[model samples]
Target: MENFIIYMAKASGLIAVFYLAYHILLKKETFFNSNRWFLLAGLFTAAALPLLVYTKTIWVDPVPMAETATRTVTLEQLIAYKQYQQQMAEKAAIEAAAISINWFDVIVGMYLTGVLLFSIRFVLDFLSIRRILSGNIVMKDGRFRLIDSEKARSPFSFFNYIVYNSAQLKQEELAGIIIHEKVHSSQKHSIDMMIGQLFCIVFWFNPLVWMYKRSISQNLEFIADAGAIQVMEDKQAYQKTLLKITVQPDCINLTNNFYQSLIKKRIVMLNKQQSKKLNSWKYAAVLPLLAVFMLLFQVETVAQEKQPAIELIKLPEAKVKFAVQIDKNTQDSELEESKQLLKDEYNADVKYENVTRNPEKEITAIKVTVKDKGQSQVYEVAGHQPIAPFTIEIEKNNSGRNVITFGNSIGKDNFVRAQAFRIDANGDLQDLANDSMHVQKHKIIIGSYGMDGDKMPLRSSVPLKVPEGHWSVNSLKIGDTDMLIVINGVKQKKGDAIKLPLGQEIAELNMVKAKEAKKKYG
Candidate 1:
């Protein structure tokens, strides 16, 4: 839900930027076709920008530790280090306990409500238009349907259907009306208007979206008017015809109304001289503006600092110990027999005890009590014993309650092993073994092998969190052995290639060097 809000916000920002550019740069130009396409392209590009956020890495050189002469540390320095460690631990504990709430839920709820209302309104408006067209007098031609109506207040067209009161106008007035509505029909201006309605429904809260819809509607009128005036014998008569319709305008949301607002501007445009062809070059500005948007908002950079490699050491096998208890009332021979039985059955180092402290409680023949091994693994680092992943902990109470826990590294040997590689910007898994698939500049096929997320192997890859790099593919081929892969460099066992979202998530490809392979395996 949070991600959805973020995407909507980005889309809104894009629409605002592109529309501002169109209004300031190309709005006054007389190229109606170019203007129409420009508005449409802007709307689509705005919605797509958020999803194209390609993540790139910014690599920095590893900083070296300062060289110092070897000397014994003073007692004061040791105390200071301990104090610093304590402060950091307390700060981490405090941060972990804090909780935060996001208010974006309210914003998303309001946005969805607006979209629902506008969507319903759009559907109803279309249904109303359909109802009006169902029972009218209809005359069909090759590409248009003419409706003869005495009730229509003004002339208008919806798709190929022209609606007007034909009984009241002279033959010339009727001819002008047909030519005007024909332009709307042939150009399919209704499609553009419908696109505007969809944009408004999604971004109803944005005032600029409303303005964009109006611009699209108005441009259709301009184009239709320009085409209709060219064929009319008396251009002044067309102007007069527009005035008649304006006096009693027919207002419908889904149709191209004849008496749209800005009557005076439409008249002025009709009389105005043709604009120079060179002025049409303003449309070229949209390309660079789109490029600027991509640079500023579409690409993201993440820092990937290199770290020292890890060396895993195998420790000794762990020893488990437990205690066996016999009842205090048991005979000496019975106690001895119970202890020997427990020691043989468990194969563990077990000690026997006769309990007299709790006289009221009686033990069975032989009761073995296993101690908690949850905290058994601890490594001494810089004179401090920090708990390791293999650690376990067990707690036992006087009330006979026992709590046992397994630490994170309890299942160290149960990990899936595979060869992994980094996915790059071209939405591909970099294949160093095959040079054609290694570099992003090379074209990668969109078949099952490519990392486009279209189709993937059933269980090939696992995605890693950020800063750890993106993907881990299992068991890529190196000569013949299947190996366990870690960070796209280390290999132990064989598995399938992991599928990932490529460009958006993965960053680099780290294949094993031939020299390293020879040294490790040969």
Candidate 2:
């Protein structure tokens, strides 16, 4: 919805620019036919220009990663960490619902309401014209069907039908009006009026759109006036005939009416001399205006190369075995469960050794030993200790890409360290790179290349640098979850920690509760 509003705003601005050019450069010219076509073309250009997009590519060096401290934790602590995160998420959701008004929803509702009202008005205007044409035909000819109606205060033409009140005009005045109406019918000026009306209905909120509609209506009249004088014997008499007709309230907006409010301008236009053939150069000015509009609103996508792909080699799998020494603290049920889990999940064998107990018959000590491909490791624990279950698996996803996972699991909670690979035709694994996976660095350019060149950079894909001595979120974490950090008013995403300024560059640092943060940011 936000994107749609932005598109409409850009389109409206284009229409305004096109209309301004016409008013200054082409409106006064005697080229009525040219003016008519130009106005129609302007509407089409405005509607289509913003949709045209160009893509470009640029290459830069990848940014280096900043070093940070890391830590290892037991399985029990990982489970507690996940539970804390779930609680925080539920709390944030509750606070988000507390917001009284969503401005986006309000704006969308208002826009839809306006569209509904204008749509109804458009339908009524069409029905009003249809009613006037019914049961009112007085004469039928090969070219037109003439409707004589008391409701029609002035002469008007709608497609092949001409409507007028014969009782309101003299014989001589009627002849001139018919000639003008006939030109409108022959040229199909009603089609232009209908198009203009539709634009007005859809863009009712834009004042520029209304102005554009007026320009179209006025140009159509001028074309009809020009066509009429060419066929009539006396040009002066036609101008006087235009003055004789009293301006009445506008008829249905769908029709081309003879009595327009611009009668004075019509008289002046009729007396004006023809413009020089060379003055047609003014139309060329539209090319530059169109170029400017494209440069300002058109979207451009650019990509740049920074580094080459890294080759990877697959190694043979290794056999793993585990040895455990049970104490009173190690329940028989837990030991059985852990042994079954290692077998099912990792294809590993587990064996129990000597058991020990204290004077109270409670678990006093436990020991574990691991052997993988002939390499062995041992660890001893006294009292309660967490033993994390580990796994290594190779699988293919829905896209047929190979996924390798090395992780520790506790029920539904998985601490994963994984990578995706694509098998080439030679049956060798290759890294899968995409927009989310950066193999190189790039800068995106979105404006016109000829006008703005590479000066207008929307953003850089390169990592930002943090000043020395700055306190950054690179090392900040909430258990296995990354901490949500905000600097100045901008919330920082993962990997944005390196972009922070130095401690002295920062004037203040503050933190808020999860609920407060959710309410303000959401």
Candidate 3:
């Protein structure tokens, strides 16, 4: 809806520009036929120019970073993170529900209402012309239909039908009026009037559109007057005939009325001398004006270049070991279970610092030391252990193989959760869960599964709060893999999803396996 409004605005601006140009350069010229076509061309160009957009891409040097580190999180830390996210989501939902009105929706409704009213007006005008033509045809021929009716106050032409009150005009006056109406019928000036009416209906709010329609009507009248004068013997008699017919109060909007309010201008144009052939060059000015508008509104510039890949640094070889020392009173089974728990859950060796005993002699609290390359960092735990901050450094070992090291942060704000993955030589993700050399294929799906109340879920990188029946995809990984993103059934190019700006909520989202995607999309 917003996009449509913007397009209308651009089109309206173009219409205004074209009309202003026409009024200044060619409106006074004795080029009625040329002016008629030029006005019609302006309407067409205004409607089409905004849609012809050109995208331009530019490349530039990437910013350099001194160092970069990935993050490795434990299962407990992941669970804690999810809980925190859920709390934040609930708080946001409460705040959103407190709001009462949406101003955007109100504005859209008002605009549509205006459009409806104007459309009805257009239809009424058409019907009015239709009713006047019915049962009033006095003569019918291949060239035109002649309608004699008391309902028509002044001489007017709509398409092939020319309407006039035969009893009110002298035979000589009728002859001149018929000639003018015939020109309108032959040239199909009513088609131009109807087109202008439609433009006015759609853009009823724009004063420029109303003026544009007037300009079209006036030029068409000028053309009809010129055509009438060429056939008549005395031009002054035709001018006098135009002056004799007073402008009617019941003039139909969709027809060419003989006695228009611009009667004085019509008389002036009738006496005006022929324009020079070279004055036709004024029409060429529209080309440059159109070019200027295209540059200002239709061109889109984008930066297409990406940052260079980071180079991995080499680190010294370090042997890591885990040992859980127990007292003579501790059972061998309990000791072995503790060692396995550290290996399976923590995925790292830890040194026990301060172990507190409960009333039953069981450990209640413990301060654990995690070591990386002989550098030890201690973290105290009570009942529930919060996520320990750590960073994973990517480097090469002595054998020139890629190595991933997990340890406490070496600098402030250096730690981040494991979100980055590197593609190996065989186009597989390196399995950080196991050895750095191990690679596997992974599938990741990110989308919303349901709506939040009446509101639809938005596709975003961050997590959002949804009701009980809904679930949004924050991030999901099955095996180790690259993702194929399809929005509204269209498969996007690599990195396009990240660059695309989403302004609307996601309506529906689905994920298909590689085999299914290939078969369905191909």
Question: Ten consecutive residues with minimal summed lDDT in candidate 1?
Answer: 65-74
Error of 2 at 316 (Å): 14
TM-score of the candidate numbered 1? 0.55
Q: Count the backbone clashes (under 3 Å) in each candidate.
A: 19, 7, 3
For candidate 3, write residues 1-522 as lDDT tens digits: 788889999999999888998999999999989898899999988888889999988974333211111222333343444467689999999988897787779878887898899888878887888888887756986779999998888889988899989888888889999999999999999999998988887788899999999999999889999999889997887888888855645677788988888789988898899999999999998788788888888999997645433333221122222223333233334534554445453354545555665555655555555554545556564653333333333333456433434444333211221223333444333322222211111122222122112211222122222212212121233332345555544554544322222112232223333454455556
Local distance difference test, per candidate? 0.58, 0.61, 0.63
lDDT (tens digit, per residue) of candidate 2 on 176-217: 888888988999898898888888877788988888988888
Q: Once model 2 is optimally superposed onto the true structure by TM-score, how far is the C-alpha of residue 127 displaced, in angstroms?
A: 1.2
lDDT at residue 294 of model 3 (Cα atoms): 84
What TM-score against the true fold does each predicted structure earn?
0.55, 0.62, 0.62
Clashing pairs in 3: 441-480, 442-480, 442-481
User: Which order, best to worst by TM-score?
Assistant: 2, 3, 1
lDDT value, residue 317 of candidate 1: 21
Q: Please identify which of the two predictions, 1 or 3, would achieve the higher TM-score against the true structure.
A: 3
Measured over all alpha carbons after superposition, the RMSD of each candidate to the real structure, in angstroms, is 19.4, 16.4, 17.5
